[model samples]
Target: MPDECQPLHNINVGVLGHVDSGKTSLVAALSTKLSTAALDKHPQSKERGITLDLGFSSFTVPMPARLIAALPCRELQFTLVDCPGHASLIRTIIGGAQIIDMMLLVIDVTKGIQAQTAECLVVGEIATQHMVVVINKVDLLPAELRHKLVVKACKRLAQTFAATTFAGCPMVAVSAKPGGGDGPAPPAEGVPELIGELVKMVPAQPRLVRGPFLFSADHCFLVKGQGTVLTGTVLSGSAEVGGMVELPELRVVKKVKSMQVFRQPVSACRQGDRAGICVTQLDASTLERTLLCTPGSVPTFTSAIAAVEKVRFFSGTLPSKGRVHVSLGHCTLMAEVTYFGTPDGSGHEPAAALRLVLDRIGQLALNENVGEFDYSTDYAYQHELHGLEGRPSASGRQCQHYGPQWALLKFSQPVTAPKDALVIGSRFDTDVSKAACRLAFYGRLVALLRAEDPSELAHLRIFKLKMRAGSIDRVAPDGFSAVCKGMFKKDTDISLFAGMKVTTASGAVGTIEGSFGKSGKFKVAFPKGIVPAAPGHNSITLTFKRYIYDQNKRNMVQ
Candidate 1:
């Protein structure tokens, strides 16, 4: 347990960049400890001289003497997470990104922005809003080249940031390696400046002491007598030495035997604290990047409905039917992407609307011939399922569906992530020849699909309403003129206009013919030259029949 008398404020900072960009070296310099040891500790990493997994270390910097005299605290503690930079290890990078409150984006002055560098920046923008760009290894360049490189790097970074959430972020130049020759080497210029900028940009960790305890475990191991240990950053609430924690996905509850922050024993730790927890009666082998939460506080589900946004850098259109890797919090799952709507006739590009159905957690496929994989009868699954009466079989395959602007994700294992959590989608390509610059998309898990019917489309309807385009303007006996609310493009196909079904609040129906006038109004033809009475407000609903998909039937139907 932590000593109550020597309390330290904890801040998590992630070191991220391209492989060989000196991310580990920067972390070691900042920590002044064997931070690189943590990286190379893994046997494979040591052999390859590259980080293959997430590595963690921490260091404390003394507060300025003046501030220390006036304030109660003497130092600030920073927990550093060094993320892997190889494109194959992108999932590991995302896992590290989720736990950190801020990021140190390392850019090698010699290499500028590489493929993985941009990907790391994109991950940073998705994972955190606070960051400091560190242009490292400036000591290798001449004074003139250093200045020119810094300016050029800043311009390129600016363009990348313009398309991301971290636009207008500040950048600083530094050299993480020790200066050659001479005593002390003047402390490696820019270290102090970078720290000062980080202090200014990163906000103090937010307190979630009152919320339910939520921890996303990134690493798990076992000790001889201490039992299973889980190490991760506390995302919300707090946990004490004797408190019980639940792994909702695994459906196991265990008592905390001990807890530590940065290797110092602690009685209790709060949100934003990176902790290593020793728990009683659990096997470490069963745990892999699982979510630990206060029992019943988290909403565990096999599916999630979300609103997705495309990545501007991806050249190819999103596939309507294909596999993807979905990263939410620290857990990554294999998923299938099902697009919802037909193209707007502008092009063959896949529709923005989508649904992601993930394979159940812990379930492995016995054969690929079936539509869905077979469920594993593991202890966790059996135990959790025993309580439910008449629950559907885990083996049954069901058709998944979504709507415009919203997506539905069905997982093989229940996820304990909270609503509004960010979900990232990446290509599931295993081809090593593909460039690392391939794009990734991200979205928010807005809600869970709780409908009893697996094929129900109620949520789809709500999503379509939010994506509604325009309404009717003039009604006539044989036809109606609808003033499009800027929803239709100038190049929109005449077939799309002619295929729309327009209905009024009073149940009047009309089929569009084509464009009516120079203005953006479409001419709609009614049946038998009879137009039903228009509602008092002239409000009408435009249903794009082309976009509607029947979930139960797994086909497009009007």
Candidate 2:
């Protein structure tokens, strides 16, 4: 398709890195048109000499053949979202990341990946699928050793991210501002090359244009007489002039008075497109960082179930029932987490069950097939999410797939979350001056518990594995009943174990009928024609599970 024959497609690219990494200058070098709030337009940002909020800018080009073949667009627009790199401003960076389709991880060549840079990298790994490593300030290196050092640095960074989603991603060396913006070098040395690389990486998948419209308003401001212009990306579905939308968080609903794509007035907007939505009867100041959507299309949840993975560089261990700040789209809220997963992945289940199933779920998670958790399946509780496994377990395990696969998050406050939104958990309480990663883990919200419907907890069934062993003392003449000893302590309440299932090592399965003689001995009743291989010679094992968060204490056997 030719450039003028089809509609324009927009791709949001977030420029993220540590403070003083030249991210704003890099965006300036790539953007042809700067939005009103772009490039440190904030007074405080200019005074502080660092990006304090997300800056928006863009440039256009002929749509690549890959995308043209996949959609009907003729022109491709690259919208650069310049995210603040300061550690304290991570919430802003996280919010910016959710609105992007790709990431440009800026690294100052003179200084390799710094503390905040690593945090941004983790955000990239969690929030987006595509990335490009921008090694900025290459001019700072000694001219004689620059080329060799760039190649060596690229190789080292590649190895560092080999186990991450960023493995083998494109690395572009650029001098966004040569001579540190003072010398007589060209404005940018390697920007066009970086753009070319990005062109080839545009996602070929079609954008969502049919669901209920959801718009994320990153920057909202009044326009003389027109209305409040919400400048952000269309997250899903489509919207047009005069369409009815709701600000669910504020309990306000309004109609779309008008819309624009980069100052070009348009009738509508679709998913993956960046635009300004004009709405009347609202104060922009009261609605900073808000979301507008078709009525009731987005849900506000007080708790959610999310699939989790450990941040490879996070030094702190995540404990069950621990509190962490969770970032979802435009907001960050504190949440208490409960961790659990299928028995096969973490080797936390009993050895008997582990031997029955040698699972490759970690391989699945590594390959990104670990979404849509199965609530019906059995799970084992963890005291805490352990670090990466150093060596294979006795079960001949695969490489370490750090962290559990699922977590139940009880938020401290209600949040509006769309389905499958990316969730990032961080310990922002950590000292900012430290070199450690405060991001504990990242994942997607697989399920939600609405604030109005507290009964939704029944759908999340994470449980704990329990096992007990005892010896069969004797069998009845009919070979159907046996007396089990040593199953519990002398003063134990054996009634709680009644009707639970147990199996003999010799292949006989039975149930604990009741306690016998008050010595913690129990009577096992096997089915007709079933018996232990030998009376007084066989051992019995009982296996069952108790749902981790259930208050009723119901026992279940598999």
The list of candidate 1 runs beyond 4 A from truth reads 1-6, 32-37, 62-74, 143-152, 159-163, 178-188, 339-404, 412-416, 430-436, 450-452, 455-459, 462-558
Cα displacement (Å) at residue 18, model 1: 0.5
lDDT of 1 by residue, 1-558 (tens): 224633666678889998988887777667743332265588998789899888888777765444443334556667888999988888888878667878999998888888788778777765666888898888888876878877887888777665445657888988877553324544566778888876665444334579789887887888887788888888888888889888877778888899877667888888778788888778888777888888877677667655454544444456544567788887788665543322231213232223332222111111111121111110000000001112123333231222123345666566677665667877757453565545456667655754445455332432122123455565563344433334455565555446667665556676767875655566666663434344455555664332233353322223
TM-score leader = 2
Q: After superposition, how far is residue 317 of candidate 2 from its true place, in Å?
A: 1.7
| Model 1 Cα shift for residue 423 (angstroms) | 0.8
Q: Which number leads on lDDT?
A: 2
TM-score of 1: 0.69
Residue-pair clashes per prediction, in order, are 10, 0
Off by over 4 Å in 2: 1-6, 65-71, 181-186, 344-375, 386-404, 450-456, 469-496, 501-510, 525-541, 549-551, 554-558
Q: What TM-score would every model get versus the actual structure? A: 0.69, 0.85
Candidate 2 lDDT tens digits, 127-150: 676899999999999999999999
Q: Distance (Å) between predicted and true CA of 324, model 2?
A: 1.1
